[model samples]
Target: MVYLAEFVGTAILTLLGCGVVAGVALARSKALAGGWIVVTFGWGMAVTMAVYVAGTTSGAHINPAVTLGLASIGEFDWALVPGYIGAQLVGAFFGACLVYLAYLSHWKITEDPDAKLSVFSTIPAVRNPVANLTTEIIGTAMLLLGILGIGANSGAVSAGQADLANLFTNGLAPLLIGLLVFAIGLSLGGPTGYAINPARDLGPRVAHALLPIAGKGPSDWGYSWIPIVGPVIGGVLGAWIWNLTGFGS
Candidate 1:
């Protein structure tokens, strides 16, 4: 059940998140060129909605980085990590495919191949491998840190403290997480497009390569490893740092 929740949550996340990118970047859409702010808000809302739908069952760890981070911090079982990540990857792939279906006709009209690819995966503004990797690491580290903080706060509430527990419960954590994502996108997203989750990038990139979209350019496989590796490393580091703080206990 948990694995299924993760899969569905991640699929929804990718669907709406990438859907916004397609809406803005694809030709013949009313929101064409809706700009970065729109993309950021759309992704944030996607996270919020997905979490609302799946948080109770799976804690809404829709991203592999989040699953790994929680495990590293001893908040999640290491045994379940692989299944969670696998589900997230599968979900993201289907979600990207849905985006392709949603904008089936727009691909041919969109002249820029990079734009089409951008709807599925991120592309760096300046392609410096080291710098791009660093940016992704930093963004993901911040994400994990914020998530741990939210979880810690929720766990800190005493059993008898109903009011305090309610502050963290009943969907507050998910909402804050969405806002945190929005903030990250606004401030830290320019470099490497803030791919803080590995599954979020790789799964969709794979879909981009497989799907027959008109004028779709190369999947940019060379740059793919950075998003995957950097976020995993960052998630581990962030969780380790949070564990050291001992906030949740």
Candidate 2:
């Protein structure tokens, strides 16, 4: 069931993700392109569906950053992180592959290197190292903060019991979590579209690198590391902040 959920979730994420690209890039006639809003909402909706489908069993952690952060807080088992990350990556890879297949016909019509690169992975909107790094850090931090809020340690409720009634009946927690992500995207996603999930960013990035296509542009290997490192650092910071404040306490 976990594997199935991961597959479906990952596929859904990629479908919406790459679909947005196709819509904005190819559907724009010849040289036109879609803007940031399409990408931001594309990912936001991807996450929403991914979590709604797999949240109960696998915690819907379809990102390495999420798995790592959850394990650090002891909310997730360390033994499971490797498997979760691995599964997430595999799922993302296949999902991106499917997207590529779906868009192959349209891909033949476009000549923009940026548009081609975007169909599989991310690229900086305003290429500045410090700014991009900071954007990723803040974006991932917001995501982690939302997760910590949603899945924080329940020990503070009682020695061995939690107030299930209030926690479940009141939808405050889940709403806050979703809004956190929306807020981050709305505020900080302008620069790089906020690749807060390492797997989400890297797996598709790999697909972009490996896939064969005519007139494809160069893979931006030099800046690829920023998404991975920035998210990890921001996730840690977000988790630390949540732990320190005891917001979910």
Superposing all C-alpha atoms, what RMSD in Å does each candidate have to the true structure?
Answer: 1.8, 4.2
Highest lDDT model number = 1
Residues 13-99, model 2: lDDT tens digits: 776776676667763444245566766666667677677767666667777777787678776788977778778888887888888
- Tens digits of per-residue lDDT, candidate 1, 27-135, equal 9899999999999999999999889989999988999888898898688999999999999999999999999999998999999999999999999999999999898
Q: Looking at model 2, which ten-residue stretch has the lowest summed lDDT?
A: 165-174
- Please report, in order, the local distance difference test score of every candidate based on alpha carbons: 0.91, 0.73
Best TM-score goes to which candidate? 1
Off by over 4 Å in 1: 155-164
Error of 2 at 24 (Å): 1.0
Question: In model 1, what are the clashing residue pairs, if there are any?
Answer: none
Task: For candidate 1, give the lDDT of residue 62.
Answer: 93
TM-score of 1: 0.95
For model 2, the stretches where C-alpha displacement exceeds 4 angstroms are: 1-4, 27-34, 151-179
